[model samples]
Target chain A: MSNRGPADTPPSEYEDEGRERLSYVVGLVLALLLTTGAFAVVWLDLLSGGAALAALGLLALVQAVVHLRYFLHIDLARSHRDDLLLILFTVLILLIMVSGTIWILYDQHIRMMA
Target chain B: MTLRGIVGLLAAAVPGTASAGSFLEPAGPIASAQFSHFGVISALMLIVIVPMFVALPIVLYRYRRGGKGTYRPDWEFNWGLEVVIWGIPVALALALGMALWKHTLEYDPYRALGPEPLVVEVVALDWKFLFLYPEQGVATINLLALPEDRPVTLRLTSGTVMQSFIIPRLAGQIYAMAGMQTQLNLLASETGDFIGRNTQYNGLGFATQSFTTRVMSPDAFAGWAEATKAQPAALDAAGFAKLLSPSVVSEPVLYGRFTPGLFGQVMARFAPAMVQGHGQAGMAAPPAPHQGHHHMPEAGR
Candidate 1:
């Protein structure tokens, strides 16, 4: 019903869809890279031991953040901000619970052993 | 609603040790108390965990596309409810934590929890428990004998990687770490054959890592030890090496007339620093002509 020809239509919608698809592929590649990198760090720690284990654990945390941000598309969108915040809070709680258990148990063991 | 249905669901969800197994019976009072503590803690946790799981689906379904309520975008926070929910669990956890701490101290392995305790030096080899009795001067592999009502102290260390020493009726699992020793105190009120095993997965032989425990009268234990000890002259270093060789299925062997300080020597081998003041300082070294100067026992022959 438009008076203008089909050539006059703006190409912004096609460009937007293409960008969404490209972001998705980038997200997939990032997820694979982070996962494999995390595994490599853990494997190296197993072979080397000691400080490598600490380093591996730290890398794992970073890789988990990378996965959540890029692969999961957890970003600055207002609608999804609450979901991202909840996830961050959950991760914090889990870290606190796990680290607390290990610290308390290790302390108790040291005292008993001494 | 139905207990059987709930049990079925639980069994489906958590397999392995959570379900019934032959290895869970207590060999002593300490183990029994520890098991009870675990049970209480698990029960308490289920009260919160089960409700959370049950509410998950309800919340998800209610929030789905075509639900009844007028969906309000402005609903932000529920601070009071959050505080109440989290506060109760925190209080409960603190109370449980204190109870466990007190009990753990009371049941400390180094302290004598009972009278006339039997001491068993447990060496976790490739896949077995080597029990050495210093007082009796006898050593046995994969077999343990103890007199009922006596407190049993286990001095545990691993030959290789870390392993967890566990005998359900005797006490909770304690670590058998390389270059380190862990002690567990156990007192058996009843006389029976209980099983002890490694709870940690170390390597290929881990699945078969187990030992037989017999709680008999003092006279019976002495008789059993004497019978096993009097078998033959398998007491030299070569004989000891043969015994120590890794095996998947080794029949129980006992040495009645063991060298007086074999236990100390074994301890020194794994943990050299701990046996400093225990008459091991001035004692002559190994019979082998190795790194240090010591009296050498004739090899095997």
Candidate 2:
């Protein structure tokens, strides 16, 4: 057999290493920006009441996505399909429990008001 | 096969001092419905639990080291066994969820059980419950009186910390919180004395924070109300201030007269604006004649 060594390694692995390091820096910047933006909206009184709430909620969603993509290395790639499906299933279960609780409480509230 | 016999058997099997206060011996429609719901849920859970328990010893003995049981070392997976293991629990859970949802709606505590409900304002203090009959213009400490077959609405609030008000024989527990009001509607099916208590632990006197609930005939209830109104004790601002101090009252105290709008005053202490608006609206609206008597005077500003 011919010599099989580091020379035989694919070029994509080196590119992947660079991209992986870069992804963490990018994720950190995005997370900090989102957090600062949320704090600024409240501290500087940039938004009020429901608008402020909506902005904070949006920033939180984006931050979650950044953490998942960079730290957890979860994405739409075929190799990550199992992890994505697992997260979706967990989310489904959470939504069912939370929404069911809210629905029951709200219905009880309405009946009490009546 | 009688319902009484079944309930009796269940009560005997359960290791508790069964008394008039027992939810297992429900005295009202709501409590009875709750009891049935609990029974159904327990039976549903046992469908899975009982079989696993029964099979444990049998499987252990048969598959022991020197036993003559057939063993398949190469066995990996079987579709039939997988279906049996997963399918039953999923189906049972779905059924249980549907049942719970249906019953929760049907037996909502706030839902009026009958027409002409007697409205009582309940204030849970540090270690006692004060029941004010808004309609009857009387109040009592550590006692609740109701007319059998007639619906009774209790509007509850907590003067100190949060507490849970429950008369297990008559209904389930509903929370009482400071600054907020919760409502419970109940109707007694028969005349009897039940026990009501604050289930939430608040302070040193939590254990003795219980009241007697007397369900009597309509005529008897009216007479009791009239007699209570004739008592010498009056609950004014001074008396109320004394009550605010945490203490366990050994005997039920009856007040011949209470300051009008006392309940509103308690509510206003925490949420002034909301209580003011509510009090004003209630005063402005003309009372429906068909509704039971309401003697609430103008709320203290």
Index of the highest-DockQ prediction: 2
Clashing pairs in 2: none
Per-residue accuracy of model 1 over B1-301 as CA lDDT, tens digit each: 2433444365567656352223234445676566556666766788778888998888778877897656988998899989979997998889789888988788776677767678887778777777878777788888888887877888776666778887666666788776556678777777877777888987788888877777898788888877877767556556656656666655776777666655446546654544442222321211111212322121101
Model-by-model DockQ, in order: 0.02, 0.07
lDDT tens string, model 2, B138-250?
99999999999999999898889999999999999999977667889998997988999999999999999999999999999999999999999989988898999999998
Task: Please give each candidate's TM-score.
Answer: 0.59, 0.74
> Where does candidate 1 stray beyond 4 Å?
A1-114, B1-24, B57-63, B270-301
Model 1 / residue A48 / CA error / Å: 38
Model 2 lDDT, residue B236, Cα: 90
- Model 2's alpha-carbon lDDT is 0.82
lDDT tens digits, residues A71-92, model 1? 6656666437778788879989
User: Measured with DockQ on alpha carbons, how good is candidate 1?
Assistant: 0.02
